[model samples]
Target: MELFTLSLPAAIYIFVMAYIPMFGVVVAFKNYKYDKGILGSEWVGFKNFEFLFKSETAFRITRNTVLYNIGYMALTTICALAVAILLNEIAKKWLKIYQTAMILPFFLSWVVMSYITLAFLDHQSGFMNGWLSAFGFEKIKWYFEPEYWPFILNAVHLWKAIGFSALVYYAGILGIDGELYEAARIDGAKRFQLVKHITLPQLTPLIVILLILSIGNMFRGDFGLHFFIPNNSGMIYPTTDIIDTYIYRALSEVGDISMASAVGLYQSFVGFVLVIAANFTVRKINEENSLF
Candidate 1:
């Protein structure tokens, strides 16, 4: 009875905040007239979804979303794992200090990060152009250049996110049995041998779980990073635009609640399918590492 009482508040919160909002998912299928309300509106079947896919920009946004997310997952996972291994090798006192400094960027919101990025990337009075002029080079407009955005976005995201991710990997590594390391050392294993033969194998399960969860969000790019960091520069839309930004622009221009809901529903549904597919493949390869 006491445990149930302790859990009641959280149960109520989830029901009120999460489960209740799920009913609004039906709005995706409806015409969603303001006067008619959600259930009273006309059901338009899959027409709303058709509109999203038929647009000329559909391929571009979808390609960008999938490609960018794949890049983030691959690059961040590699970097985080490397950092975690290095952190594990460090003394505890320095580890704590480095961990705190590394995670400070993760604590910052994307809006704050946008301003920080702008300080460095801004054309006339910015750090990059200032350095270029000092070196006898022409000032380059970073914001207006689509070609530079892919690398810029990836770098910013890695700076903010890799620390937290590395900490998670480090925690998983710390959970590994110390006696196993002792045994490996007594067996004449070198540093690289210890990492390759022990640390990585033990960390595999956690790595697989994180990778699976990240794959589930492959269709949804970070909206704030793409939108705010780019300052909504239209010239950079070719590289910087993604599904979340595309949906935001569509709703802003047309106020189509049904269409917005449909696109959102599509993202959720495809992400669900991809997660299932990825887990299934992983399970087929190795049941122990698979996220069930």
Candidate 2:
């Protein structure tokens, strides 16, 4: 009874915020009308989804979304692991300062960071241009160039997200049994060897779980990062455009609620499949590590 009482608030929140909105997924199949309301709207089966798949830029946006996320997930995982290990190795005297510095970026809003990025990348009167002028190099329009954006976008994402991820891994490292490390040290294991054998093995389960969950979001790009950071330049669409941003654009411009819902539904479905596949692979490799 006490446990149920303690969980009631979270149960209510999940029911209200998550379960209730699930009904709106039907909007993906409906030719919705404001006057008719959600239930009263006519059903169009898969027409909205079909419209999404048939669009000319659909392939491009999908490719960008998947590739960018895969790359981001891989890079951030490696970097976060490295950061966590380094944090764990640091003397207690300096741990807090390093942690605070690392986590500051995670708290910053994308809107604020967009302006911060503009300070350096702006073509005219920007920091990059000012430096280039002193060296006799032409000022490049950073936002107008699509090719440079892949690296830029990945760097931006890692800067904003690595902090929280590393923090999680750092906590996981803390939870590990200290006796194991003591025993390893008694055996004359070096620092690198201890990390390679002890730390990495202990972290594998957490790594697998986080990696599977990340795979689930492979289709859902961060809208604010893609939209605000690039300033939504048309020329950079080939590199920066993603399903989330594309849906935002369609809904904002055409007010096509059904199409937007369709794309969202597609994102959710693909995410679900990826999660299942990743979990199954992990299960095959080590049943103990699988999310199931």
Candidate 3:
């Protein structure tokens, strides 16, 4: 009774804030009219979904979204783990400073990152162009070029995300028993040998769990990065466009609520299935680390 009373407020809060909004998912199937509103909107069965998949841009946007997320997840995971291991090796006195510097970028808003990125890549007055011109090379229009965006976006994602991801892994490393390392050292293991045999093995379960969670969101894109960093220049949309940005453009520019809802529903449904499937695969390989 005491526990129930203690948890009552949280239960009510979840019902009001989380579960209640699920009813809006009906909009995904309806021809949502503002005049009719959500409850009164005409039911269109699967027509909205049909339109969502039929558009040529749908394929392109879906491909870009999934591919970018996969690349981001792989790169970020590898880099973060590497950074975390390096930080763990450093002397304890300098650890806090390095961790703070690494994590500062994660707290900055994407809008702030946009301006920082512009400072470096702005074609006419930016630092990169100025340096190139000083070297007697012609200035390149950074934003206008689609080919450069893949590398640029990957670098930006890594720069902004590595700190947080590394911190998670670092915490996992710290939770490990110090006795294991001491034992390994007494067993004549060198530093690299200790990392390879002791540290990496201990961290594998946490790594697998994080990787599975990341795979679940493989279809989702970080809209702020794509939308703000490139400044939504249409020429670069070929490479930068993703489902979230596409849905935003549809709602704001085309005012197509039904189509936008359909796309969103598609993304959610696919992500749901991907998570379940990924979890199933992980459980098959290692039951202990599976999220379920």
Candidate 4:
């Protein structure tokens, strides 16, 4: 009774914020008419989903979305784990300072980050251009070029996101028993050996869990990073276009609520399946570590 009472607020919050909106998934299968309303709309079966798959932007956006997310998952996991290990080795005096500096960027709004990105990449008065021109090199328009965006976006994503991911791994490290480390040291294990055996093994479950969550969202791009960092330059859309950004543009420009809902539903369904599959695989390997 006590536990049920404690969870009542969270249940209400989820019902209000999360589960309630799930009804909108029906719009994905309907030829939604605003005047007719959601329930009154005519069912269209898979027609809306067909439009998404057949559209020219479909392949490009889907490709970019999946590829970018895969790259991010790979890079961020490796980098964050490295950073977390490094942080774990820090002494008490400097650990607090290091942690504060690392987490500061995670708290900044993407809008603020957009401006910061613009300041450095702005064509005429930007820091990069200024430095290049000072060295007698011709100034390049950063936003106009699509070639540089992959690296630029990845770097910015790492900068903005690594702090939080690193902290998660840091917490995972904290949960590890100190006795393992002490035993390693008593056995004359070197620092690198201890990390290779003790730290990495202990962190595998957390790493796998995070990886599964990341894979579940593979089709969903970080809209703020893609939209804001590139400043929505049409020329760079070839490379930077992702499902979320594409859907946002469709929503803002065409006001196609049905299409937007369809895309979102597609993403959700795929994510749901992937998460289930991932959890199942985890269960097969180690039942206790499975999310369910």
Candidate 5:
């Protein structure tokens, strides 16, 4: 009874926020009209989906979404693990300061981050250009160049996101039994060896669960990061354009709500399949580590 009472608010929240919104999914199939309303709108079956798949930018957006997500997941996991391990090794006196500094970026909004990026990347008066000039190099138009965005986006993402991920891993590290480390030390195990054998093995299940959850979002990209960071430059669309941003443009520019909804539905379906497949593969490899 106590547990149920404690969870009641969360249950209500989920029902309202997550489940209730599912009814709008029917909009994906309907040629949604303001006057006719959702139920009264004409059913177009798969027409919206067809329009999405047939669009010229569809492939480019989809490819960018998937590749960027893969890169983000891999880089975030690796860096988070390294950061967590380092935090675990730090002296208690300085641990809190290091943690506060690293985790500060996680709280910053993407809007703030975009402006920070602009301050550094602006062609003429930017910090980066100033440094380049100091070194006798020509100023580069950072936003106009699509080639540089992949690296810039990844770096920015790492800076903003790694803090939260590292904190999660750090908490997991804290939960690990201290006796295991003590025993490892008694066996004359070096720091690297202890981490490789004790820390990594103990954290495997936590890592697998987080990875599975991340894989579910493989088809979705962070819209704010891709949209605001590059200032939505058309020239950079070749690399920065993603499904989320594309859907936003479709709705905003074309006002094709049905098409946008269809694309969103497709994104959700693909993400669901990826999660299931990833979990299945993990189950096959190690049943204990499987998410479900």
Candidate 6:
């Protein structure tokens, strides 16, 4: 009875928030007229999906979304693991300070990050341009260029996300049996050898779970990061555009709610399939590491 009571609130919240909203998915197949409402609207079958599949910008957005997510997953994991290992070596006296500094960015809103990026990247009266002038170099227009955005976005995402991911990894490291490390040291194992043979092997299950979860988001992009950071510049769309931003533009500019919903549904479906496939592969390799 106590356990059921403990879980009751979460059950109700999930039913109200997650399950109830699922019914609106039907809006994707409907014309979604304001007057007719969701269920009352005309069913157009797969007509709305055609907007996404038929558009010339379709391939560009899809490629950007998948590539950006893949880059984020791979780079974030590597950097986070590295940072976590480094943090484990820090002295206890300064550990809290280092943790606070690193985790601060994770809590900041993307809107704030966008303005912070603007301050540095602005062509005139910007820090970067000022440095360029001092060094006798041409001032580059950061927002107008698509080529530089991939690196910029990756750096920004890392800055905001690495702290939290590192914290998770750090905790995992702390939970590791200290006896293992002591035993390795007694055997004359170097620090690198201990990490390679002991620490990494123990952390492999956690890494696999996180990776599988990240794979689930392979079809989605950070909408705010792509949209606000570039300030919605058309010139940079070739590099910065993703499915989430594309759907927003479709709804806001074109006012095609049904089409936008269809694209969103597509993203959700693909993400779901990716998660299942990833979990299945992991199960085949190591049943213990599989999310299921």
Tens digit per residue, CA lDDT, model 2, 1-292: 9999999999999999999999999999999999999999999999999766898999999999999999999999999999999999889999999999989999999999899889989999789889999999998999889999999899999999899999999999999999999999999999999899999999999999999999999999999999999999999999999989988988899999999998899999999999999999999999999999
Model 2, position 213: C-alpha lDDT score: 97
As for TM-score, the candidate ahead, 4 or 6, is 6
For model 4, residues 1-292, the per-residue Cα lDDT tens digits are 9999999999999999999988889998898998999999999888887767988988899999999999999999999999999999889799889888988888998889989988999999999999999999999898889999999999989998899999999999999999999998999999999889999999998998888898899988899999988999999999998999988987899887888888998898899898899999999999877778
Model 1 lDDT, residue 285, Cα: 97
Per-prediction TM-score, please?
0.96, 0.97, 0.95, 0.95, 0.98, 0.98
Model 1 CA deviation exceeding 4 Å by range: 1-11
Which of 1 and 4 is ahead in TM-score?
Answer: 1
Task: Indicate the residue-level lDDT of 105 in model 6.
Answer: 96
Q: Rate the local accuracy (lDDT) of all candidates.
A: 0.94, 0.94, 0.90, 0.91, 0.93, 0.94
Query: What's model 3's overall lDDT?
Result: 0.90
TM-score result, candidate 5: 0.98
Pull out the clashing pairs in model 3: none
Which residue pairs collide in model 5, if any?
A: none
lDDT (tens digit, per residue) of candidate 5 on 1-292: 9999999999999999999999999999999999999999999999999876888998999899999999999999999999999999889999889889989988988999999999999988999999999999999999889999999999999999998899899999999999999998999999999999999999999999999999999998999999999999998999999989888887898898899889889989998999999999999999999999
TM-score: the better of candidates 1 and 3: 1
RMSD of each: 1.5, 1.1, 1.6, 1.5, 0.9, 0.9
**Candidate 4: misplaced stretches above 4 Å?**
286-288
RMSD of 1: 1.5
